[model samples]
Each structure stands twice: as C-alpha cells, then as structure tokens.
Target: MFQKILIANRGEIALRVLRACKELGIQTVVVHSTADADAMHVRLADESVCIGPPPSRDSYLNIHQIVAACEITGADAVHPGYGFLSENAKFADILAAHNITFIGPSGDHIRIMGDKIEAKRTAKRLGIPVVPGSDGAVTDEKEAKRIAGEIGYPVIIKASAGGGGRGMKVALTEEDLEIALQTARSEAGAAFGDDAVYIEKYLQKPRHIEVQVFGDGFGRGVHFGERDCSLQRRHQKVWEEANSPALNAEERSRIGGICARAIADLGYSGAGTIEFLYENGEFYFIEMNTRLQVEHPVTEAITGIDLVHEQIRVASGGGLSVKQEDIKFNGHAIECRINAEDPRTFTPSPGTITHFHTPGGLGIRVDSGVYSGYKIPPYYDSLIGKLIVHGRNRVECMMRLRRALDEFVVDGIKTTLPLFRDLVGNADIANGDYDIHWLEKYLAKEE
Candidate 1:
C-alpha cells in the first residue's frame, strides 16, 4: 500500500479521495490553487501545497508543478479525482516515469479510451455494441454525406476528441448535414485542437446508461450494475440513479456482464465506466470515462462497495477484493448534482456561502466540500456537492430524495436546488419516463 497519495484535483472529489486514504491508513497531500487556499479538502488533508494561481491552466492543469509537489511531499501515488489531468495519458506516463503510481488505468489504456474515435473501434472490437455510422473519422464533404445517407439521415457529427456536448451537432436531413459538419468541425478544432469529427446515427430518445466497472490489471474484473444519467442538460448530467429504472434485472445483468468481461479482457485496472445510449432494447456505446465518475456514489450505495478504497487497493497491486458472483446489488439509489448555479438560467453562481445545511437520516448522504462562510470562487466548477439517497426501491428512493432535497440548504449564492426540487415533483421524473433530451425539453417548457 502507498504510504502517501497526492490528490491532483479539488472540490468534493478530492475530499472524497482524502477520506478513503485516511480509512486505509494512507497519508494524503492535497495540491490546490491560490483560489482554493481555504478549501475544505486542503484543510482536511494531512498536508497541503499551493501549486499556482486561480487559472486552471496555471494551477490544476500544470503538470510540472503537480509532479514537483509529489516529489516534494514524497507522495508515491496520485489519485486524480476526475477532470483536469485525470484522463491525460501524458500525465500518467510522467507519474510512472517518476516512480509514482497513478491510481487508475495505464497511460496506454487512457490513450486508447480517451480518443472518441478509437474508443468506438475498441468497444466494437471487444464485442461491445456501438452506434451505426462511419467506420472512422470523415473529413471530406462527400464522405460525410455518404455516411449520413447510409445511416438514414438524422445523423450526429461529433468531435473525435471532445466531450461535455461540445463539438457535437445533429442534422435532421441531408440539407442540414453540410452546415452541421462545418460547425462541428469548427467547434472541435477550437475546443480540442483537433478538427477530426465522426458521424453516428442519432437516436431520437435514448437513456444515458453507464455500467460501473472495475478491474485488477491481472485480468480479473467485476461490475456494480448501471447508472441512468438520462436526466441531463447541455450533455452535462444533472441527476443520476443506480439500477436504471428503464432496465430490468435481466438487461442489467447482461450489460454489466459484457462490460466486466471487456475490462478483464483489456486488462484494465482501477475504476472505469462504459457509457452507452440505450433505446428500444438496444444499447449503443457512447464513450468510456477512464476515471471515477461524479455520480459514483449512487453505485456505491446500491452495491455496498467503497469504490475509492477499492481503487487504492487495486492500484497498489492488490487484485480485486470481491469476485463477480460475490458482488450483490441491494437497493435503488439517486444522486443530485447540487451545483452553485441559477436553477432557471443555469448561470454560474460564485459567492460566499452564508449558510450551508445538509440533509441526514437513513438512506440519505450528502458529499460536499463546502461549508457556511466558504467562498465559492469563480475560478473552478460551480458544483457545491452531491446528494445521494438510497432506498429499497425506486418509489421509496424518489420519496427519500424529495425529502432530502427539501432539507438541503445553501445561502448567499444561487444553486440548482430549486431545479431538482421541481424535477423530483414532476410526473415524468417521478415515473422515470425521461430520455437524454427530457431535461432540455422540460427546461424549454419552463422558459
């Protein structure tokens, strides 16, 4: 086991990793930007280092500074808690070269899965289903048009190296394809520095389902079922739930087994999520997240597994602690991403939190790094925390989530709490009758 681990990110996820390290008797070194001088993670870590200024490029994303911090702190491993350098293959290689383990997959795996185009090819090769469209990146207008026509129109153009809804455009007909391709490529080049784009058959209404998978690098793996992140806005997940209400036990088992086998076959290590677009009894691969997801709490709640703890152990060369058949799914769980943003406009809200009150009781958990009087800086993500609730079933889980959301309180800044409150009360959300487009449509109606 690593004596000390450096957390290479901030906010709730950094705090989350810190706690896990503490539980496993591992000391922690938290690196923070000047903007986060008084952040909760820094306060709670065994040691803290100020890396740079507020801008992410100068601070969180500065690889040299982070590596220096690790060397200075004598930290043997780095747990990049999502975002920033979490999926950077170069960062992983740098850490390995310095004799520090990255508590995730190898740089090779990250490289393969980080590229959207290559990820699709790898998924298809691994016997995982993928969307029907172009075999690879399409550059010329003629080839783009040909693929769009073969896919029967309504095709989506996506950046080969993009995420979070950027560099993506949908064309309902052939007339829209040209403009859509141009816009998508432009956005791709601007956002990712890569003009490469691919075409995929666009599904009208598909649920965003992702299977939580873990591997031990020694060809052993297991799955903790699926999380339904269908409730999204601008491609960002707003709400997530475990054991997707849209899928039955059989479907869940089938998909989970497939993901687990794939991870084992690829010899992947640590935590990874295989995301898919599910519709009408079919699942088309979307992309794979090479790190822990923000919505992982819901899966942990249902599976009785401490994923962070497992991640640390596996990265330390300890094989999987639990076998595939030994893992059990227990209950329904829901997670609401409580962000510091206007519920209506979705604008970022950054200010001092005058009051912070979290909900408690059986089946309710709030994972946050903020407190009363904590100033939410404008330099980083506006997420305040995550509110996760678990119950015996979906109905019970919904009731518990509603009660918990009411109990959650934050002041001195706008938050999306109101949005979640309204969503939990809606008939569609209550019945889980929603798809990837449901949240946008609901927000449009509100407008």
Candidate 2:
C-alpha cells in the first residue's frame, strides 16, 4: 500500500479521494489552484500545495506543477479523480515513468479508448454490440455525405476525440449534412486539436445506460452492474440511477456478462465504464469512459463497494478481490447533481454561499466541496455537489430523493435545487419514463 497519495484535481472528487485514502491509512496531498486555496479538499487533506492561478490551463491542468507537488510531498501514488487529467494517456505515462503509480488503467488502454472511433472498433472486435457508423473518421465533406447516406437519414456527426456534447451535430437531411460536417470538424479542431469526425445513425429517444467494470490488468475483471444515465441535458448527465428501471433480469444479466468478458479479454485495469445507447430492447455501444465517471456514486450505493479503494488496491499490483459470480446487486440508488446555476435559465452562478445546509437521513448521502462562506469561482464546472439516496426499490428511492431535495438549502446564490424539486414530483420522472432527450424537451416546454 502507498504511504501517501497525491490527488491531482479539485472539488468533491478531490475530497472523495482524500476520505478513501484516510480510511486505508494512506496520507493525502491535495494540489489546488489559488482560487481553491480555501477549498474543502485542501482544508481536509494531510498536506496541500498551491499549483497555479485560477485558470485551469495554469492550475488544475498543469502537469509539471502537480508532478512537482508529488515529489515535494513524497506521494508515491496519484489519484486523478474524474476530470482534468484523469483520462490523459500522457499523464498516466508520465507518472509511470516517475515510478509513481496512477490509480487508473494503463496508458495504452486510455489511448485506445479515449478516441470515439477507436473505442467503437474495439468494442465491435470484442463482440460487444456497437452502433452502425463509419468504419473510421470521415475527413472530408464528400466522405461525410457518403457515410451519412449509407447510415440513412438522421445521422449524428461526432468528434473522434470529443466529449460533453462538444463537437457534435445531427443532420436530418442531405442539406443538413454539409453544415453539420463542416461545423463538427471546426468545433472538434478547436476543442480537441483534432478535426477528425465520425458518423453514426442517430437513434431517436435512446436511453443512456452504462456498465461499470473493474479489472486487474491481467485478463481478469468483474462487472458491478449498470447505471441509467438517460436523464441528461446538453449531453451532460443531470440525474442517474443504478439498476436501470428499464432493463429486465435477462437483459441485465446478458449485458453485464458481456461487459465483464470484454474487459477481462482486453486486460483492462482499474475502474472504467462502457456506455451504450438502448432503444427498442437493443443495446448499441456509444463510447467508453476509461476513468471513474461523475455518476459512479449510484453504482457504489447499490454494490456497497468502495470503487476508489479498489482502484488503489489494483493499481498497487493487487488482483481483484471479487469475482463476477461473487458480486451481488441490491436495491436502487439515485443521484442528483446540484450545480451553481439559475434554476430557470441554467446560467452559471458564482458567488459566496452565505448559508448552506445539507439534507441528512437514512440512505441519503451528500458529496460536496462547498461550505458556508465558500466562494464559488466561475473558472470550472458548475457542479457543486451531488445528493445520493438508496432504497429497497425505485419508488422508495424517488420518495426519499424528493424528501432530501426539500431539505436541501443554499442561500446567497442560485442553484438547480428548484429544478430538481419540480422534477421529483413530475409523474414522468416518478415513473422513470424518460429518455436522453426527455430533460431537454421538458426544459424547452418550461421556457
């Protein structure tokens, strides 16, 4: 086990990793930007270092400063919680070269799975079902048109290296294809420094379901279960639940087993998620996240597994402790992402939090990084906290989530709490009758 671990990120995920390290008797060194010097993670860590200014390019994303902090704190391992450099293959390689363990998958796997096109190919080769799309990146408008025609109308153009809905466009007709191809290429180049784009048939109203898999990098792995992240806005997940309400027993078993086998065959290590789009009782691979996902808590709530602890253990050369047969899924869990934004307009809200109170009760958990008097900077993502609840079933879970939302309070700044409060009582949300575009359309109606 590592004596000390450096957390190379900020916000709740940083604190999440810190708490995990403490439980395992491992000291933590948190690196923060000047904007986050008073952040909760920094205050709670065993040691804290200022990396750079508020800008992410100079701060949270600065590799040299983070590496230097690790060297100064004598941290033998680094846990990049979720964002920033978590999925960066070069970052993992750099840590390995320094003889510091990265609590994640190998660089090779990251590189292969990070690209959207490559990930689809890999999934198809592993016998995992994938969406019908171009064989590779479509470089020109002519090729894009050819691929889109072959896939039929209503196709989506996506950046080969994109995420979070960036560098993506949908074309419903031939005329739309030219504009979509050009715009997607430009956005992809601007966002990821690669204009490469791929085409796929866009399935209408598909549910976003993802399977959580863990491996030991030796052709051994296990699947915990699946999370229903179909509740999304602008490609960002707003709400997530474990053991999707849509899948039956047979569908769950077959898909879960397929994910486990694929991961084991690929010799993947640590924690990763294989995402799929489900429509009409068919699952098509969308992409793979090679790092811990933002919605991982729902999975943990049902499985009772400390994914971070397992990540550290496997990265330290330990094999998986649980097998596919030994794993058991229980109950249902739901997570609501609380962000610093206007409930009506969804505009960013960055200011001092005058009064903050979190809900507490049986099976309710709040993972946050803010406190009363904490100033939320506008330099990063709007997400400030996540409220999670578990219950014997989905109905009970929704009831608890409603109660929890009513109890949550934050003053002196806007929050999305109001939005959730309204959502929890909606008949559609209560019945779990929603797809990926459901939230967007609901919000549109409200507007």
Candidate 3:
C-alpha cells in the first residue's frame, strides 16, 4: 500500500478518495485551485496544496502543478477523482515517467480507449459487439453519406476522441449527413484537438448500461456488475443504479464476460468501465472509461465493496481481493448528482451556500465536498454533491430517494433537486420504462 497519496482532482470524489485512504491507513494530500481554498476536501485532507488559479486549465488540468504537489508532499501515488485530467492519457504518462504511480489504468490503455474510432476497432477485434457503422473516421461528407446509406438512415456522427455528448450530430437523411459532416468535424477538432469523426447507427431509444471491471496487474480481473444510467440529460448521466432493472442473468453474464475479455486483451489494469448501448435486447460497445466513475458509490452500496481501496491495492501490485463467486448484488441503489444548477434551464448557479443539511439514515448516503458558507465558484463543473440511496428493492429505493432528496437542504444556489424531485417521482421513471431520452422529453413537456 502507498504510504501517502495525492488526490489530483476536487469535489465529492476527492473527498471519497480521502476517506478510503484514511480507512487503509494511508496519508492523504489534496490539490485544489485558488477558488477551492476553502472547499471541504481541502479542509479535511491531512495536507492541502493550491495547484493554480480559479481557471481549470491553470489548476485542475495543469499536470505539472499536480505533479509538483505530489513531489513536494513526498506522495507515492495519485488518485485522479474523475473529470478534468482523470482520463487524460498524457497526464498519466507524465506521472509514469516521473515514477509517481497513477492509481488507474496505464497511459497506453487510456490513449487507445480515448480515441473512439480506435476503441471501436479494438472492441470489434476482441469480438465485443459494436454498433454497425463506418469502417473508420469519415474524412468527407460524401464518405459519411455513403456509410449512412449502407448502415441505414438515422446514423449519428460522433467525435472519435471524446465524450459527454459533445460533437455529436444525428443525420436521418443524405442531405442532413452532408450538412452535419463539416460542423461535426469542426466541433470534434475543437473539443479534443482531433478532427476525426465516425458514423454509428443510432439506436432510437437505447438504454445506457455499463459493467464495472477491476483488474490487478497480475492478469486477474473480476466485475462488480452493471450500472443503469438510462436516466440522462443531454447525454450526461444524472442518476445511476446498480443491478439494472433492464438486465437479466444471461445478458449480464454475456456482457460482463465480453467486457472482461476485451480489457484482458489489452492487458488492462486497475479500475475501468465498459459502457454499452442496449436496445432491443442487443448490446453494442460504445466506449470505455479508464478510471473510477463518479457514480461508483451506487455500486458500492449494493455490493458492499470499497472501489477506491481496491484501486489503491491494485496500484500497489496486489491481486484482486474478490473472486467472481464472491461478487453479489442485492436490492437497488440510486445516485443523484446534486449540482448547483437551475432544474428547468440547466444553467450554472454559482454562489455562497447559506445552509447545508445532508440526509442521513438507513439506506441513504451523501458524498459531497461543499458545506454551509462554501462558495460555489463558476470556475468548474456544477456538481456539488452526490445523494445516493439503497433499498431492499426498486420501489423502496425510489421512495427512499424521494425522502432523501426532500431531507437534503441546500439553502443557496439553484440545484438539480427540483428536477430530481420531479423526475424519480414521475410514473414512467418509477415504473422503469424510461429510456435514455426519458429525461430530455420529460423536461421538454414540463415547459
């Protein structure tokens, strides 16, 4: 185990890693921007360092600053708690060359999986089912149109190197494809510094499902099951649940095995997620997240596993602690990303939080890095906390989430609480018939 570790990110996830470190008898160091000087994670960590100014580029995304903090603190490992530089392969590469262990997949794995086109090809070669589409990146509108014709209409053009729903355009006709090509290429280039874009058959109402995988460097790996992130807005996941209501025994085993095999083929190590789009009982590999996901808590709630501890152990060159037979999921768990934003319009509402009261009780957990009097600066992501709940079943889980959301009180700054209140209580979501587009259409009708 690492004698000490530096967390290279902020917010609830940074705090999450801190707690795990404490439990493992490891010292914790936090790196925050000037704006987060008073953030809860900074206050709670045994040591804290300011990386840069309020802007993320100079702060959270500044690899040198983060590495410098680690060097100064005499830390042996770094835990990138999602977003920002978590999936940035170059950052991981620098950490490797500096001899500071990055507590995630190797930079090579991240680099390959970071490119959507390369990832798809890897998945295809590994025999993991991928959505039928173009052979590679489309360099021209004519090529895209040609591929779309063969793959049928309603194809989607996606950035070949990034996610979070950016640089995505849906074309249902040849004319639409021609118009979308240039714009998508431009957006893709701007977002990821790569002008490459690829076409894939877009499922009209697919459910987003992902299998969580953990591998120790010794070639041993096991899965922690699936997260149903079907409840999304604008392609970003808002809430996630474990042991998806959509998956069955046969399907789960098939997907899990295929995903494990895919990562194993790459000699993947540490924690990662294989995300897929499921529609009409078919699973198509979408992409792989080469780090711990934000919503991993819900999986922990259901399975009673500490993923961060596992990551650290793996990074320390320990084999997987749990076998395949030891894995089990019970009841249901849901996590709502409590962000400082207007529910209706989804705009950043950064301000001082006058009051903060988190829900606590059986089956409820709150992971956050803000508190009363904390200022939510407009310098980063709007997410302030994660409100997760577990129950004996889906119905109980839904009801518990409602009560938890009600009990969660953040007096200042607009939060997605209102949107969640209106969402989980809705008949369609509660009944589990909602697909990936459910939240979008639900919000649209509210107007």
In order of TM-score, best first, we have 1, 2, 3
Clashes of each: 0, 0, 0
- What is the Cα-based lDDT of residue 342 in candidate 1? 93
The digit string of per-residue lDDT tens for model 2 on 405-426 reads 9999999899999999999999
Query: Which of the predicted structures, 2 or 3, would earn the higher TM-score when compared with the native?
Result: 2
Model 1 residue 403 distance off true place after TM-score fit, in angstroms: 1.0
RMSD of each: 0.6, 0.9, 1.1
TM-score of 1: 0.99
Q: Candidate 1 residues 1-447, lDDT tens each?
A: 999999999999999999999999999999999999999999999999999999999999999999999999999999999999999999999999999999999999999999999999999998999999888899888999998888897999999999999999999999999999999999999999999999999999999999999999999888989999999999999999988989998999999999999999999999999999999999999999999999999999998999999999999998888998988989899999999999999899999999999999999999999999999999888898999999999999999999999999999999999999999999999888999999999999999
Which segments of model 1 are wrong by more than 4 Å?
A: none
| lDDT to native, each model | 0.95, 0.93, 0.89
The prediction achieving the highest lDDT against the true structure is 1
- Could you estimate the TM-score for every candidate? 0.99, 0.99, 0.98
- Cα lDDT tens digits for candidate 3, 1-447: 799999998888898999999999999999988889998889989999998899999999998899999999999999998998888889989998999999999988898888899988988998889999987889887777788989898999998975888889888888888777878888988988988999999899999999999877666678888999999999999989987888888998888887776666767889999899999999998998999999999889988999998999889888678887898888899999999999889999999999999998999999988989998999888999999999999999999999998899998789999988888778888888878998888888888
In model 2, how large is the Cα lDDT of residue 377?
A: 96
**lDDT (Cα, 0-100) at 437 in candidate 1:** 98
